[model samples]
Target: MNIMKRFLKYTALTVMILIIWVAAIFISMDKGWWHTPFTQDKMPNEFIASVQEELQNEFVGTMAIALFKGGKLAEESFYSNDKPADRNTVFQVASLSKFVSAIGVMKLVEDGKLNLDAPVSRYLTRWRLPHSDFDNTKVTVRRLLSHTAGLTDGLGYAGFKNPKDVQSLEASLNKAIDADPGSDGRILIGVEPGSEWRYSGGGFTVLQLMVEEVSGQSFDSYMQSEIFEPLQMHSSFYQWDENFQDRLCDFYETDGSKAAQRYYTAQAASALYTSLADLEKLFHLFDEDNVNQKPVSPEFQKLMWQVEAETLGTPIYGLGTFLYTELENGGFVIGHDGKNNPPINTAFRYNPVAKDGIIMLTTGSTNFATRIASDWVFLQTGKVDALLFTMQQGKMIQIMAIGSFFILILVASIAFVRRTGK
Candidate 1:
């Protein structure tokens, strides 16, 4: 009996040591001091499997990932045991739509139809922003695209199932611009526009109005002609088309409940349905533009990569994308992340120097997509940024550590009691 107790005691001690070691590792990883080294050569499939396992264990509903090599689509995979999610499944890439919106705006600018520094009032003839004490003239297209337009957030109208249920740009502005006439929350121009950075989903909606007015075409039609159709990005559409309905991925909420058939109407800000394979076509434009193919102007493309604005405690905003500083040569990783509903998380990051990138889309709310993108960025650059992983679960990890320690203590106590009784 004593020998048996000794064995358990040793086992319990080993368990306790392991718990502490794991706790230390997690803490170190959170603090950006540790990482699971990954190979850059071919994208370690084992690491991806591990990430997928971790995501599944955490109850993430679905995942799709694609990697680009030499600025071309190289590898792609899908993960979801609960439902049908595959390589071509279209996901509502929320804020990622903003990048496309910016691209459309830039295309017009390249043709001299729109001016960046000009006041948005030049084109938004259908509707106008409400009057405020702040100078509205400073609210230029450049500020709006860069998120420094100083406009307040609009009423979020993203989850309505019927595309028609989504309000029109004129309606969104009328409601968001004032109280009683529109929404509960009115968009406020609190500060001088262009003087500082502020994120306004409403600003993009406002741009939708400008796109229509200036081009004499519907916002969706303009994008189709100028960007998507020209680039052969057949799978991307700004609104819900019957053709994409069958290809849409199921969205899951944070509680792991499947989202009902919902469609977002914020066409400029969040209402884009696309697959990773389709997005590669859009990314290829950036690559060709980098080499001066003039799909868009070289000057405008260069500006897309330049740092435009940044807020305190957040990544730098470059045009419609966030600037990632993780890559080694100190170049830049350009892309955007999107969340349509709580459970829908997507990340797309691109490297300019090597023209390589990775796209991640998931129906999990954990922001696991960022971690996956960060891992690739790290492997490419040999430098890490933003912890790359482990930033979102500090409390859960701590609880796990403490719980494991207590379990170890309970086992040791049981062994001690057994030995004494014998």
Candidate 2:
């Protein structure tokens, strides 16, 4: 009886301690205890210096950063590993391509070539979504844009080394070489559409096909003519062109070794080569004041940023973009980030209301751009966003350690009680 009492007391004490420790972590994170302080009075030069210092400390190689204030370029900087890199140096922005593709889809909607609420199957003739238990009619363009089409294929394209090996858009959609060979491998509805949010690169591939079918042109060609030409993003391309060979930034592994450039058949989902200079033009697409010949109508642009899905009551994603956080005044900090194997990371974020934003692209660093962008958000808003939590490696390690220790203590206490009672 004495032994049982002792064991129970100790177990109770351990539980209380663990609870306090976890609570402390949540408190510190909520309060932005790990964030760097910034003030409005800080000069642009000072802010730039701080960012440069971070890049050096993180050991990033070949980076380009641009700052936007009041919807205009406030500052820009470039760093190189060995060869010269500048604003014109093109980089393969992985999933960021989806955001651009969303814009293309919206453009078609505005031009009466497509409809957002219409079933995606209505727009495609070349390929259809694979059969699934869920009602296919619910898989609309709007749902696809928001990743609520019930697609279970969480595909991250492992781009091909040889351009010739790239599958046709229809073939790639049928069976992505990199995807798992199970039910989750193919693009099929796993849940009722609009019931939940699931990231699906395959969903965007369907949009690519729809664009081709509706526009009567190839995906790359349609994007070039309708989106890139209007935006004057001359350096942007969905397909490789020999003209860009000399200007493309060489891909690098995290260890500073050169990585071969990869090709992707999923052009709308994973293949967009763009430069910082061109990205600046793309940034203007969000400027409400620049109303001359907009790619998407103002009404549609407003719809694009509106929350389309939530995770546990927190608005996570809008149509084709991420809603990082909402400001007190109801405006949202919106943008997209992209990552690819062989170590490339890119982040672009702006608060549409604050009219301030940051764009960072890096090679030879894993998620370095996103980490820096999270810091920038804290500096601007005095609050941490959701993305920061995803990147908190140190905090995660600490929590995992505490969890393991708690489990061990519970197991030992159970054994002690059982042995004592026996």
Supply candidate 1's per-residue lDDT for 410: 76
Candidate 1 lDDT (Cα, 0 to 1): 0.73
Q: What is the C-alpha lDDT of each candidate?
A: 0.73, 0.83
Cα TM-score of candidate 1: 0.77
lDDT of predicted model 2: 0.83
Clashing pairs in 1: 175-182
Off by over 4 Å in 2: 1-24, 35-43, 179-185, 400-422
TM-score per prediction, in order, is 0.77, 0.88
Please, what are the lDDT tens digits per residue for candidate 1 over residues 331-415?
A: 5788887765556678888888888888888875656677667777777765454435435357546856776777678777877
Cα lDDT tens digits for candidate 2, 1-422: 98778778767777777777676776677568865543333344566777777666655668898988888789898888876789999999888899888999999888888888999999878898888898898999999999999988888887888998988888888988855234344676889899999989999999999999999999999999988998889999999998999988878887778888989988998899999998888888888888646777778777888999987577878889988878888868988898887678899898888788988888888888888787788778777776886667477568757775876677677767877788
Look at candidate 2 and tell me the lDDT of residue 300. 78
